[model samples]
Each structure stands twice: as structure tokens, then as C-alpha cells.
Target: MIQPHQHADQACSECTQRLGLIESGLRGVTPVRFNAAGWYRGELRREILRLRLNQDVSVLKAITFALQRTLPAKALLVPIPSWKTQKRANPLPALICRSLGRTTKTLLKRCRPTVGQHHLSRRQRLVNMKSAFAIHPDQQSWCVSATPTWIVDDILTSGATAQEALHTLKRAGLEVRGLICLGRTP
Candidate 1:
């Protein structure tokens, strides 16, 4: 069973509430804004273990529950890559995707470096993140047969990042099933 302390003792109200929503019906999924709304505040980060705990467990549980009932077929969990790997330690999307994956670890990779999407304007964000992601050539064997994937992320703002990831995966002949995020700005 999943343990709460496995992540951290602190759980934000947003995380709790989100878990509830995802548990109910899998709709009303929103992205958690770490920058603008300061959702990624140091305290929240520490509490949520800097998103290391599968802080979005609620979200993953929802996806798992749905997939178990609807699409029993195997699925791939692909995450948008982080530009800098040394700092953050681990990519939250990739981590979350691994938590949800049934048959594999993760297939998405960032082949190119891009600037932070937060500082850029909508247009800039799109341009900056373009071609930022690619399926690891080494993992082609796994993805070649895996149809329909879930592009996982911590949040969904303009959807540019996830869209770019989808575009790259599709070019590699992988079918994207849907996009899953912890929260979204509605």
C-alpha cells in the first residue's frame, strides 16, 4: 500500500482536495502552478517533498482507476523533460508517470535544452519549448508496440509543453492517448 510518510509529513490542502476530486470521477483535473501562484513555495515543496512524494498521488490514482476500468491494455507514461537535470534532482512529471506506469518505467526524454517556460511569454514559451522533447532512441523497442500514451506533467498552463511532447512522440510513431496533469489554470 502507498504510505503518506513515504513522501512527506506535510500535505497541502490543494493536494488533498485534488486527491479527492481525482478519486471521485477523474474530471476537473487542474494543474498545480509552481511559479506564478507560488504553489511551488519552499514550504509547500518541503511539505510535499519538493514533489518527490508523488505529491499528485491523487491524480495518479484517478488515472490508474480509470485505466483499470476503461483501457486494461498496457500504457506508457511519458513526461516532459526538465532542461536542467542537476538542480531539481528528479523530474516531477517523469516521477509521477513512473508511479502510474504498469508495464514500463518511462519513455519520454528531453533531447534538447530549452529555457524555462515560466519567464517566457505565451509566444516565447511555445517557441522556447519547441523540439525540446524526444523519445529516447534506446526505448524505441518498448514504444514501438505501445500505443496511446499519457503525457504527464505537474501542471497544464498553455499546454505548449505537453503538446510539444506529444508532437515529438507522434513523430516517432507513438500514439498519444491523452494528457494528464496535477492541475490546470481554468
Candidate 2:
């Protein structure tokens, strides 16, 4: 339903159950719109896909507007690295970061290419994403703080990607507070 605002707690367990995550909670007010039918139905999926693949910002304004309003005031936003190795010419996390810079900023970068998770099992997804991210050298300072970060991604499925990202950040001494996504796989 995308609530206009949601509060950030010190932490939450629901995400732990759903994503096997530690050191993070789910973002506020945003709902999973990817389904057979509903608010984020057909056209929305196509638009999101378009934006993800082509960097089309034409349809993401509403999501960005909601994100700007709902993001926690105290934390920075760490976008989960995009999958495209060629260059993130377009992708959801990149697009969101462009609009979310005020309440949050990015500190992680994909250090390597990852195998796509589309056809993988949970175990495979976890293995595939292991060590897939690295904190930027210049952003190393951001990793030093116990200050929480909201790990943003385009979707939540098995959560392997977010879990891996969280672990990578933790490995670098960064603290992750939550997972923010545009949708949840249905």
C-alpha cells in the first residue's frame, strides 16, 4: 500500500525470518506491488522493468517521491550493487539513489560480477552472491561508523542478495539497519 511514512526502529525480527537477515530491518511504507494483479500490476511491472533495463525514469517518479518521504532521516542509504557488469547504465538501485541522496547516500560497489539468481535455489543464490560486493575505498570512512544504513534494492525474493550484501557490509565494519525495496516477489 506504500504508506507515506514509516518509522525506523533500532531493529526488527520480521526481516530476519523472511530474509535470514541480521543487522537490518525492512524499509517503511512501501508495499510489494509485483503480483498478478493490484496497484503495481501489469503496466507498473513493465515500467519497472523498463526502468531497470533502460534507465527510464519516466515512470519511477512516484516511487522516488514516496522514498524521499519515507526514508529514515538519520541513516545513509547503501544501494545493493547492480547486476549489470558492463556499467550500471540503468538499474533500480542506481535510479533510486539519484533521488534518495538527501536522506541517504551510497557506500558500496560491486567488486565482481555475479551469476544471475533467476533460476537458482536458495542455497545457490546465497553461494552465488557470496562476497559479491565491496565497500568503495573512498567510502571506507562510511564503513567505520556504527551508524545504521538502509540497504536498498529493487525487489525481495529469497533475500539471498540482501543477506549477502549485509554480510559484505558487516565484513567491512558497516552496520546495516534495514532492507528497502520497490517490490517483493509474489
Candidate 3:
């Protein structure tokens, strides 16, 4: 079994709550945010932008290494889809899965782009992302999994994106085992 990998003697409440919502059978691996001022405070945010630019493979390799240290080698990875208008459209979630040598699939597509989540409350986030994803007909086979699969993202703040993705996968006949993320925003 995958032992808890958060701060050993303590657990972040958000992490616990998120895992609970996602249900059991799979695990998550994420590094703590610096939670300080200046550069450290926004490190994760900067890295996310960097990943999307698709210009820093070396940095992504390092970040992916940290992300996979606690995950199972065999679980399939499903990355949340980015908006179609993105110039590069490379998401950190998929890049990390590739780095971990996991079988990764981008099975979902944005049905419509939603507003940014920066100012949204939990319920607002859920509503904003509703029906935001659709499983492309040709990509349907990727979600047919005997082994447990994970829905991954760059960060987990309110978990609205994760929840929506999980539900969308279930609607497509997928049984998601867990949600994984690179960082937990404080």
C-alpha cells in the first residue's frame, strides 16, 4: 500500500479532504508550496506557466521526478485538458506522466473555455467548469482501463477541476481511482 507522503506527523486538511472526495484505490504525490513571500511564494505559479510554454523540458523533468516518487508505476494517467486557444497547449500533468514512464492519455477536450479560477469560490468553480470537458470519440478507448487510472493536474486548490474531470470520465464509462497533483495551493 502507498503510505501517506504528506508532512509525516501532520496532514494538510485540503489534501485529506480532496483524497476523500476522489475516493480510494490510488495515491497522490505533490510537493509543498513554499508559502512565503516573493519568488518562493509564486514558484509553483511560475513553474506552471513555464510548463505550458513548452520551453523548459529540463525543469519539467525535475518536477516530474518529484511528482512520481510516490505513485505506482502501472497506473494510467489522464491529464485535464487545456483550452483550445492556448498557443502551445502543453500541460504539465501530461508531461510529468510521460516523464514517469507511465502510459499517459489525453482523453478529454474542452467543450468550451471557462473563465480563470483565480477569483472563483468553490461552488462557482464547479459551476464554471461544468460540462467543460468532453471525451473525443476517437479517444474513448484510452479510458477503458482494467488497472486503476489517475486524473492529474498542475495544482489542487478548490478541487473543482479535479471533480469535474473525474465526473466527466465516469460519464465516459471510466472508473477513476484517484486524483494527483503537483502542488497544493495555500
Winning candidate number (lDDT): 3
TM-score of structure candidate 1: 0.65
Ten contiguous residues with the weakest lDDT in model 3: 32-41
The alpha-carbon root-mean-square deviation between model 3 and the true structure, to one decimal in Å, is 9.3
lDDT of each: 0.54, 0.58, 0.61
TM agreement with the true structure for every prediction: 0.65, 0.68, 0.70
TM-score of 2: 0.68
- Candidate 2, residue 12: the lDDT equals 29
Model 1 weakest 10-residue run by lDDT: 29-38
Candidate 3 residue 103 Cα shift, in angstroms, is 0.6
Model 2 C-alpha lDDT per residue in residues 1-186, reported as the tens digit of each score: 122223531112342223222232223332221111112334444555766666644334444544555555676677776767647433677666555554455677777778778899988987888878777788777778877677877767777888777777788887676576655554
Sorted on TM-score, best first, the list reads: 3, 2, 1
Clashes of 3: 0
Across 12-79, the per-residue lDDT of candidate 3 in tens digits comes to 34433432322221233322111111111254456556666754545444444434544567777888
Q: Which of the numbered candidates is closest to the native, going by highest TM-score? A: 3
Ranked by TM-score, the better of candidates 1 and 3 is 3
lDDT winner between 2 and 3, please give it.
3
Q: What would the per-residue lDDT of candidate 1 be over residues 39-121, giving only the tens digit for each residue? A: 32333224334355444655344333433333335766666667777566445666555555444435677777787776677
TM-score of 3: 0.70
Error of 2 at 40 (Å): 6.8
Off by over 4 Å in 1: 1-73, 87-90
